[model samples]
Target: MMSKEDKIYLELEDREFPFSYTDHDRKIVRAIVFDEEKKFYFVRIHRDDSFGKATLIETSGGGVEKGEDLETAIQRELKEELGAEVEILQEIGIVSDYYNHVHRHNINHYFLCKVRSFGEKNLMPYEIRDFHMESLKLSYEEAIREYEKCSNTKLGRLIAQREVPVLEEVKKMLLIN
Candidate 1:
């Protein structure tokens, strides 16, 4: 279980925390876009508000605009973040919790997305300083190893378990021999 301090840190890191208690609550969406070649995973490098430093985060998503469905939010975020369109494969999971001193509540929707092609990456002014599609392929074990290096946050754990249908689907899509 996460301590109150840890939960607060996470909410601040995600920028979901409001300055005042009366601020309107909002939903945020993010995508995990992977290429079939297994060469690169799209990610953003940004300064975490809570951690006070820049870090590479393996997610592409943003706030859910008013009256928008989750899928629409995901698509809009992908285009806004990466300048690329994608076909969402499935909803991997959801993480919901409260961050004391930060957000009253937060629910992050995770999705596995397939990109048609790698295009120019466009970073949103706030969430990203720069972005890239790097060549890093990992087996299930390797993925877990990498995830272990980071704090055991929900996102980290999810990335550790990313070897499931996502990897399998990628292998099938690329026809890796």
Candidate 2:
């Protein structure tokens, strides 16, 4: 199995800090997805359920099902969330973090992909009803700004803290400011 320890970087005290942590329990795939016109796909999740906190903006992705390869899992996730077909450009990096909402450690595989086409979304019912998930296309800078805005609240900060490093990795690879 591919290990993510070599690729992990963490933040502490509001600064980028290099760190390494990995365990073999869960696999989630996150896409740093771009459209043909160069806009990135992002998900805005408005979680109003009993379990969730702030309305969150996040990159497009989901849990990888058992027996599915990473590539296939990403493809399925993109389609489900954004209703888009994507040509994966590269495996950007893996980010390790823990989600307080779920109280589980995450091993997230991040991929760079270009959207090939779009159609109707196929979101899970609770995701639609409770999370109120919505899809949006954003310029790289706009996406970063969304993160900044979400960081205002406590729960939002928890998610942003985990995602910002992955977003930074994407910016570094694409030279997006």
Candidate 3:
């Protein structure tokens, strides 16, 4: 069994909603995806009032389908969201966050990934219509700013809480190696 120090676990509460519990769990895979230039790739989403009418930058990922391994799910999410083939350099750890308004808990598995190549994106219809999802590439400082800027929205706050620490961890790892 792994000790507490061996894993990075984050638990996030839903302060924006009055709901007190989560009824379902979602297993997800996300990446801090970078290219040879050291710029990171993310998804910029323009959402409506479901969360709020705001634009947000988020790590490119989604729910891991049944029977899909974490590696395969991350690979597929990158292909569909960013049109890039990535090399999974490291498994960062997990973030346990709640979407109380939706009654769902997210078990987010994060990875440090490097882009290998690019191709056409095959986005789902809902992702295109509902999220207005688009790919964004940003430097470390720019990404930090984007996260802070986007935190004006409810969903953005949750995303920033979940991702920013992981981003910092990845920075330290890169500096060490």
Cα RMSD (angstroms) for every candidate in the order listed: 8.3, 5.1, 2.3
lDDT scores for all predictions? 0.53, 0.76, 0.89
Please state the error at residue 20 of candidate 2 in Å: 21
lDDT of 3 by residue, 3-32 (tens): 255656777777876787778999999999
Per residue, candidate 2 scores C-alpha lDDT tens digits across 26-104 of 7889998886566888999886554445778898888999899999999999998999899998887776666444445
**Ten residues in sequence with the least summed lDDT for candidate 2:** 11-20
| Candidate 2 global lDDT | 0.76
Q: Show the colliding residue pairs in model 3.
A: none
**lDDT value for candidate 3?**
0.89
**By descending lDDT, how would the candidates be arranged?**
3, 2, 1
Residue 23's lDDT within candidate 2 is 38
- By TM-score rank, best first, the candidates go 3, 2, 1
**lDDT, residue 21, candidate 1:** 52
Which stretches in model 3 have alpha-carbon errors above 4 Å?
1-5
Worst lDDT window (10 residues) for model 1? 5-14
Q: How do the residues 1-177 of candidate 1 rate in per-residue lDDT, one tens digit apiece?
A: 123422211222323333345334547676656666444354434344553333343556767888999999998878766777888887755545444344345566667787786566565554443333333345434443445554345444333343233444444545655
Clashes found in each candidate (C-alpha, N, C closer than 3 A): 0, 0, 0
Model 2 stretches astray by more than 4 angstroms:
1-24, 50-52
**Whose lDDT is greatest here?**
3
